[model samples]
Every structure is written in C-alpha cells, then in structure tokens.
Target: MSNDVFTPSRPAPGRTRFTTGPLPVLLASALWGTTGTAATYAPASAGALSIGAATMGFGGILLCLVAGRSALRVLRSAPVGLLLTGALSIAVYPLAFYSSMALAGVAVGTVVTLGSAPVFAAVVERVLDGVRLDGRWALAAAVTVGGGVLLITDGVQLGDAGGAVAGTLLGLLAGLSYAMYSWVAARILRGGRHGSRAVMGAMFGSAALVLLPVFAWTGGPLLSTGVGVAVTAYLAVVPMGLAYVLFGAGLRHTPVRVATTLSLLEPVVAALLGVFVVGERLGAMAWLGMAGIGIGLVLVLTRR
Candidate 1:
C-alpha cells in the first residue's frame, strides 16, 4: 500500500514545492472512497464503532511504523494542547463518519461528511487564523455543498427520518472533526518543524490510544468472520493507512482550504461505489448531484 506515485520531483525554474501533485491526492481519495463499500461487506455483527476503531487503531500503528523515530519525536516534543486537540478530532472523525454511513447509507453519508468539510475548514481558518475566503472558493463551495444537499433530498425514506437526522448530525460532527485535524496538521506542516508523516503518525497514534478501549468493547465481532477480518484489514491498510500517507504528502505543500476542497473527490467516488459495488440504487438526480460535486472540485483545482 505504498504510494510512490507521490514522490517529489524537481520543480520548474524559480518554483519550489515539496507537496505531492493532485494526481497523488486524487488517487489517495479514490482509495478512501472505498471505505463505505468495503464496510458493506462486513458482518452485521461488526458495528460502525468497531469498524472505525479497527481502521484507525491499526492504521495509526502502521503510520507510526512508517514514520519511525520522527513520529516518536513529534509525539513527545509537540505541545500537549496541540496534540490533544489534534488527537481528539482524529478519534472522533472515524467513529462519526462510519456511524453516519451505517445509518444513512453510503452515498448520503459520504456526501454529507466530505462535502461539508471544506466549509468547516474555511470557517475554522477564518475564525481562528483570520484567513479570508476568496470568491472562487465561495462559489465552488456553494455548488458542491448544494449538490450534497441534493443527494439527500429524495434519498431518505419517509419513515427513516430519525436515522437520517441522526446520521446527518453525525456527518456534521465528522466534517468538523476532519476540518479541525486537517487545519491543525497543515498548520504544523507550515511551521516546518515536523514532516507530514510524523504529524499523521503522532496525531493518529494518540487517537488510537483513545479509541482502543472502545474497540475492545465493540471490535470482537469484526474478528468473528473471515470476511469481516479481511474487510477490516483492507480498511486499515489501504484507505486509512496508505491513503493518509498520500494525504500527508499532499498536505506538505497544498493549502489547507485547497486540500479540503480536493478531498471532495472521496464522496464522488464513494457515491459511484455505493451504486455499483454496494448495490445501492441511485436516481438520475443523484447522478447529477455527483456531477455537480465533480464540477465544483475541478473548478477549485483549476482556479488554483
């Protein structure tokens, strides 16, 4: 699950960038989009909490292993408050994200979680860091988030209002958690005091410590069947571990807002997976919604 595709190359004359190109980030996001589809294969006994815990807990360890001494150093030397903040977000994100999908189905949950992240990220930056949103970003966000809203408009069944409501709320939590971690991680990378690998490893590892006990309570079912075990392993190794490695690479040089916008790819791919692999049905409007999100993503990336 290595991502050699993100290896840095020499920049053009007078240009210097260490971050990965969009291709790598897009590829990583495509991998992440598979999480919901993969989770669908898990046994019914494997709850969302267990799925999230196994993915992050195991993936965090793998990331730490990949980062080695740098990861340890960052974890030890980083400010306690910063580490705690990042870790709290990390711990909550997967739990809420997976729960959202479990309750709301893949397409809607993925859309809500990833679609709202850029907005949350923008607000976090503006309020805390005093960064201002540009018109292009505002336009892109509007179109993308509007598309996400379209996805859930007619998708939820009449009697499932409670589940839909709870799922959407959890999705918001996931989005905010994601934005917080991304902003914090990007800020840390901007400082040049830690590499992306170290930051990801430290943040996720700390989160794993917080999540392990929850996994103990809920994860036994994930190991009950071969299919469950395999799905869990795939989620950890590919989407959670390898994808984050590529995400870390991208974050090295990309602005946090841009990075969050680029991540819209995840939901688009997830929607397709929900329809094809997960056997979820989507109407023409849902397809159009996916297209709108894609268009918005293209606009944002090209505007940069």
Candidate 2:
C-alpha cells in the first residue's frame, strides 16, 4: 500500500498552520521526551552508542516496512543529492547525539543539541530555500533557546574539560545534522510528489543501513538482559519510529524553523520525567526556565 494513506488532511478554514501544525510536532516531542529516561532503564552493559544505533536502526527498518513500496518509489524518484544528504544527516544524528551525552553531562548535551537546532534550521531555510526569518520567529527562537539553556543547565558538571569540549562540538554537529535532515525532508514534501511517510522511510531506511553496522559492533550488551532488550525495543518503536511518523506529519503543515522550535517541548517533558519518575530534583531556576519555554511556545503558536 502507498504511504499516502497516512498523509494528514489540510487545515480547515480560519485555522492557520501555526494553530494546526504544532499539535503533531508537540506530540512527537512528548514521545521523544521519554527517550532519556527510557535509556536509563537499559542495562549497564548497553553502551550509549549501541543504544543509539539499535534505536535508529530498528526504528528505521520499521518505518521502511510501514512505507513499503512508497518508500522504494521515493528512493527511485527523489533527487539523488537531496536523498543522500538527508540520509547521511539522519545517520550522523544518532551517533553524535549519543556520544555527546556520554562525554558531556546529559543536560549540557541535550541543551546544546536541541537548543542549537532551531537556529541551524533557520539558517538552512534562509540559505537554501531563500526564506526570510520574521521577527516573531526570531524572538520565539531566542526565548525558547534561552529557556532550554536555563532549564537544563542546573547542577550540570562537565567532568574532564577536554571531553566537554569534544562533546559540545559533537552536539553542534548533531544539531546541524538535525537541521539538514529536517530541511531536506521538508523540501521533498513541499515538492508535492512523495508522501511524508515515503520520504521519512526512504531517508531513514537508508540511514538504517549505515547505522546497523554500528549496532552490530556495539549492540551485544543489549542482549545481555531483559531490561536492556525491553528498553531498546521501546526506544526503537516509540520514540524513534512513531515519533518520527508524527514529526513527518507535522512537517507537512509546519515550516522547518517552527517545527524545530516546537520541538523545544521535548526537553521540558524530559525534565519533568526526570524529576517525577527518576527522582531527580530541579531548582527554582529550572522551574522558571520551564515557564520560559511555555511562554515561548505560546508565542510560536500564536497567529497574528
């Protein structure tokens, strides 16, 4: 069956993209928020790289299975340069993201990666698409990024200065990779040819081929315990697979910059989960930062 079956409907009259677009992205972000906490449940034997590889590798395959022939069609017909760029970006994201968290603290890594994505996405749109950024988006982006930094930076310890530097660099690379893939997918979807699922599956499935080798190299520990296996399964199925499905759907109605900004909600959800589920404590600044993120999101969603 064609992946167009999953295509979202157009917004009703009087509803703007800002009004209708953020919901699916927000939902995807919520699912993505569970990833950090979920990774904690994995066995010690499971290295961060292995966990990342398994998550994207299995999840990408699942998306390909779901997209079926449509994905194959997209691979055949989409611009080769665009497809390769998107696929390579997708492959790099997980590896850099996981490694950054391993070297830097989770807070620093998450903040750097997610916080930098909106800016990078905006730049991509500007340079490649000739899109101009408006004041509202700029303000909203600044607010969201500031909030994210404030929210995640509480009590962060960057052990080993050299490792921190390396991790921060990797985090930046991950952010750029994220922006590139988002732009490429949005570009493909905007072309009005392939379905979102087809684009997602084609790009990510090719990325899976690249990542599976890494998984094979580092994924042995995942088989060492039931908890590890379960964690890996959950990460693959829920956050990586289903979340990207929602993300792709959101991309249909949302601009890349807005979509990336909306995704700031992920860290908020992650922080809440960390506090409530993982018994981590948050300071007043963290609460204040969360509020800032909420305000920023409201700005992004408002239609003027």
Best by TM-score: 2
Please give the RMSD of candidate 2 to the true structure: 1.9
List where candidate 1 sits over 4 angstroms from the true fold: 1-21
lDDT of 2 by residue, 203-285 (tens): 99999999999999999988689898899899999999999988998898889999999899988999999999999999988
Lowest lDDT sum, 10 consecutive residues, model 1, at 1-10
lDDT of 1 at 185: 79
For model 1, residues 1-304, the per-residue Cα lDDT tens digits are: 2331223344442223423545557778899988878888899888999999999988988888888888888877778787889999999998999899888876667778888898899999999899988999888888887777676564656238898889989999999999999888777666666777888888988898988888999999899999988998899999999999888777866767777878888877877887788777878777787788788887777774
The lDDT of model 2 is 0.89
Query: Model 2: how far is 210 from its true place, Å?
Result: 0.5
TM-score of each: 0.90, 0.95
Candidate 2 Cα misplacement greater than 4 A, ranges = 1-11, 14-20
Model 1 C-alpha RMSD to native = 3.6
